[model samples]
Target chain A: MDIKEYKKYAENRSKRTSSLKNCVLAFIGGGIICVIGQVLFNLYSIFTIEEHAKLLTSASLIFLAGLFTGIGWFDVLAKIFGGGTLVPITGFANAIAAAAIDNKKEGFIAGVGAKMFIIAGSVIVYGVSFSILYGVAYYFYLLLI
Target chain B: MKNIIKFPEPVSIIQSASVVGKLEHEGPLGQYFDMYEDDIYFGKDSWEKAESEMCRRTLSTLLAKANMKYIDLDLVLAGDLLNQCIASSFGLLDCNAPFLGLYGACSTFAEGVIIGSNLCSTHQIDRCAALASSHFCSSERQFRFPIEYGGQRTPTSQNTVTGCGAFLLECTGYPPYITECVIGRIVDSGIKDQNNMGAAMAPATVDTLMRYFNDSGKSANDFDIISTGDLGKEGYEIACELLYKNRLDMWGKYTDCGMLMYDYKKQDVNSGASGCGCSAAIAASYFIDKLKNGCKDILLIGTGALLSPVSVLQKQNIPAVAHLIHISNSRN
Candidate 1:
């Protein structure tokens, strides 16, 4: 077979996924996670320093996501809920926790720590670089004004 | 024709066994496997070691079922989804027979049977054992990601099977013999996506099937069943279309070991089940059981993606191959 023809066949033979279903699941699941975070923030607001409420809510969501990942519930949710579980801070926590749990057999330092960032590594890299760029831009803006 | 090997002499598959880890036992073909593990690790500390243990169990179980000892085999053939075929080397360390460790990725078992059957038929060996195994944990860390890495898997991604299969072949057994094998050429589709292996591997599967049909002068409909290993759901569909385009027209009576090895899409196995264990375990356990139960003929095509982490990092395209063995319950 011609190389071009073969490439076309390779690319096109498989079935396409249902995007409509995925969008629906993501919308619903993501809404629920956001609601939980808001509830946590409200609950913490009444008890602790009002200034710490946002931090408390983030910490609570991360903790819960990590816990669910430890028990293998996060994967089930991720598979079914699609982007719902992954569009929040809870997903970030799940990534770190999942890597740690998966590599537990490989050992703490080399296996877990080394591979813990494979997926999340790109996110961290971009985050830091963008923050630095924004900081420099803000400083320049202040001087120019 | 040059790539096809014809076995004119008589040989037979004596017995076989399949051993799987925890998650696989919940799949559709769970009942067909000889045994399954409740523990993912198979009682080993490391995932690599556990994979080795899986190979060991299948080897022993096949021998026990055949009422034979390790010393009875003239040679032992095995492989795994690892860098060095270490699982087989470490797993069968105690066997006194000479070992030939092969690496055909997921198709290692078919490669084993092709070689083992030829040896027995040619009178070079009276009895030979062939086994292939893979573990999800060991394979994922080596080939793609750490199990703990929370990356979103594509719909095309397939879960590596945590299992192994063993086959004992001899000069003459109760039934079924491997008649011919069509060794595949390396077919590269220029696919660089490591996550979508099913698509990457489909072209090679088509190439081998075409070669087999042309060289053997047999139509695709001639076989009662045609099965490819570890192509999962998407790869299987693609290969079917490619077959039609190539003029073989193998549209029906086709199944994939990767799909059948599982209960079929119930597990969140992304695309489907994959790895060396997918074809090996399913062929040895499920297909053999079916043959014994009156399913007469089968074409077991072992397909594999020849890609390494280094190769993928170097931006090399994944080249794939498929080797086929024509098996039947009768000597006719």
Candidate 2:
């Protein structure tokens, strides 16, 4: 069909699209996601053990985020924010916590230990898997050196 | 010949444009950021700020497109996933449109449409508009946890779309007919796995889709397209399998908002999707594209998981629901 014809038809079908309310909910939900991130950053800054401890702070943030994911607070945020909560460092935490929590009910060894690795393990595996592939390039650099 | 009732006036496109913004992953915002961002640590706050900025930009584009003044619109109807509807409210501030805040989880889009259609249909407000926006950040913090608290996520978990979508519906002298009322049904499966939301909400999606088919007395083949919200790969597969098993073969085209919004190849996202806005945004952008292309009869199914983390932690199973909206171009 011609451009004009297509445009006309498109407008007719467009009504089915979600109205403004849904978008607003999502936007607010997105904002809520950021608020949590800010709070975490603030807490990390306040609990500084040493000067210029960026690595330590980052690690703690990751751990705390995961811990909250386990306790169910992060999940609640996920529900409220929708995509907002799931897209950040908090999501990583949620993944780890979910694995650990999911395993906790089964038992510490196979359940807890095995389940805890459900998501984190995958991250590590993927990380290692890709690093190995890319690490080959590093080996070449070492050989050249 | 079907005696279809047509609203004397049509809805006009006073103006329309989509805006976008970026965010950092941290706390509340991270929830949304996590949905779509592959490598980033921005959180809900960043999502919120970005979302607000997007709305402002979209509103500006709408005004520019329509070549009208901000004060021209009689009313602005909006909604979001946050507690007080901050992003919509804040972003609309730039648009200068009068506001009406609403919530329907993922169904907010329809809510806006119904209300906007009514306002224009009744001629109660001339030149009124409706807008909707969803961001990744703000949603995470309020519904889940703060970044400072930190947490772990499940593989079944869906990452929020690190993006926002908006729509502008205007009332015109020649408005699109508000044909049939396709209300959503709340179906609960009592399954608590957030990761398996598609499974949890599958029943609802199927139930609603079939019911709408029965109510309309129309077969699945009658519609040109069928769409669902947030049912990603698992939910989508389950929906088709169950529908096929029940002998309710959906012959029409079908798609999910979660699967289409982002390119998985570039992102490598596991399982298709999440986020209430997934359906909303898809319905706005993609659906419009389809409609404009001449495909008429359409079915829109929006699925939502009513299971909260607190409820799950409290030992409650998850419950999911789906709402079906029917759309067509048979208004004459």
Candidate 3:
């Protein structure tokens, strides 16, 4: 068969991942992480202002994710939770920490320092650019109003 | 003229050994492996070094098991799933033999055997060592995400096996000789998904199998076993169906090293095991034993997807190759 035909044939034969199952798992896993964040936010709010509590909650989650990555638990959790473990502050933290840990053996400069952002670099770049664009757009609208 | 090369005199596989990491040691074919390290690092500081160390141990075990020394080898043909094939070069650094580095992606092991056997059959080398290795951690960092990255594996994705296999081939020795081999040609099936490697590689497997059968005039029933290197589940199924459509029935005699490496029900390996080491370890340990134990003839086709990380990122289609090696118990 031709390449095009073979591609279609292979695609039909290969098993696809269940989107419904993944969505359910992601919903539950992401919900649990958010709940943890909410709990931390509430606990911090008991002793601090709303702004400080938010910052503290983010910090705590980042710390926990980095710790779990170091202990090699983050990957284990990731296998089960899939995208649920991602799309969170903790996931971003885990990505940085994991890259750092993976490259530690190569030393500080070329290894950990340079590659620490390998996975998160694209996210940061796009995220910051989009935010700046939104900020400029919002400023123009405010001036017109 | 056929592309197949038939040896005037069979090159004997004198000895073989396999070394694997913890996950592979816990696999279904765990007991068949010669040695395994509980530590994935193999007591090294990094995953790359760990892979090199695995290769070193595999060669050492092969030599030790054969009651031979490194000095006895005239040439060492080795490769791995590492950049520039550093795993083989650095791992076999201490071996005083002449070395030839090869790159065929996951088909490196079979490529090594084909070249090594050709050299041995031509009486150019008295003894040659063929080696290949791959480590999951190292491969992941280079090809996919970081080891600790929170990413989900697609159902069609395969787990790279952390293992190494070494085969000691001589011009003359015991049975289970390399009688014939066919070097594969690159074939592209327009598969862009890196996660579904099995699908990308299945067409190449079918291409090579068809060529081998057509040229050699051999039927599937003639061999005791016909196995592909690391096609995993999706590729294996696709290959079977494709071959069946072409009127070549490979149902009962067909199997894949990727499928044999792990237990589908128990192991969380989505599609199955892969990597260069997947086939190398299985062929070295399990199939070698089977050949030794009265299995008359066996055909091992090492399948490889030749897509680099850069190429895949650029959205290029994956090109694949499958090399065939005909191993038989008798020279005739």
- How far is A50's C-alpha from truth in model 3 (Å)? 1.1
The root-mean-square deviation over C-alpha atoms between each candidate and the true structure, in angstroms, is: 2.6, 17.7, 1.1
- TM-score for each of the candidates: 0.91, 0.60, 0.98
Q: Compared with the true structure, what per-residue lDDT tens digits does model 1 show for residues B194-295?
A: 877888888888888877778778776677888999898888877777777766777677889888866553667778989999898888888998888878
Q: Candidate 3, clashing residue pairs?
A: none
| Residue-wise C-alpha lDDT for candidate 2, range B1-332, written one tens digit per residue | 22122344545433344433332122222332212333222322345656666556556665666687778878877766666777678768766667888766665665566567656766887765555666554555545533333333443445565444444555443322334445556766555555566666677777777666665566867777788877767667767777886678875477777666555565434556666556655555556556668877666776667665568669776666665655555553
Summarize candidate 3's per-residue lDDT along B1-332 as a digit string, tens digits: 46888987899999999999888888889999999999988888888889999999999999999999889999999999889999999999998789999889999999999999999999988999999999999999889988888788888999999999978998665787999998999999899999899999998999899999988788999999999999998899889988998899876899999999998998899999999999999999999989878788999999999999999989999999999999999886
True contacts kept of each: 0.37, 0.03, 0.85
Give lDDT tens digits, candidate 3, residues A1-145: 8989878877776677788988888788889999999999999999999999999999999999999999989989887777888888989999999999988988899999999999899999999999999999999999999
Write down the worst ten-residue block by lDDT for model 2 chain B: B25-34
Best by lDDT: 3
In terms of TM-score, which candidate is strongest? 3
| DockQ for candidate 3, C-alpha atoms | 0.80
TM-score of 2: 0.60
Model 2's i-RMS, to one decimal, reads 14.3
- CA lDDT, every model vs. true structure: 0.85, 0.58, 0.92
Chain B TM-scores across candidates: 0.97, 0.78, 0.99
Order of candidate numbers by DockQ, starting with the best: 3, 1, 2
Backbone-clash count (model 3): 0
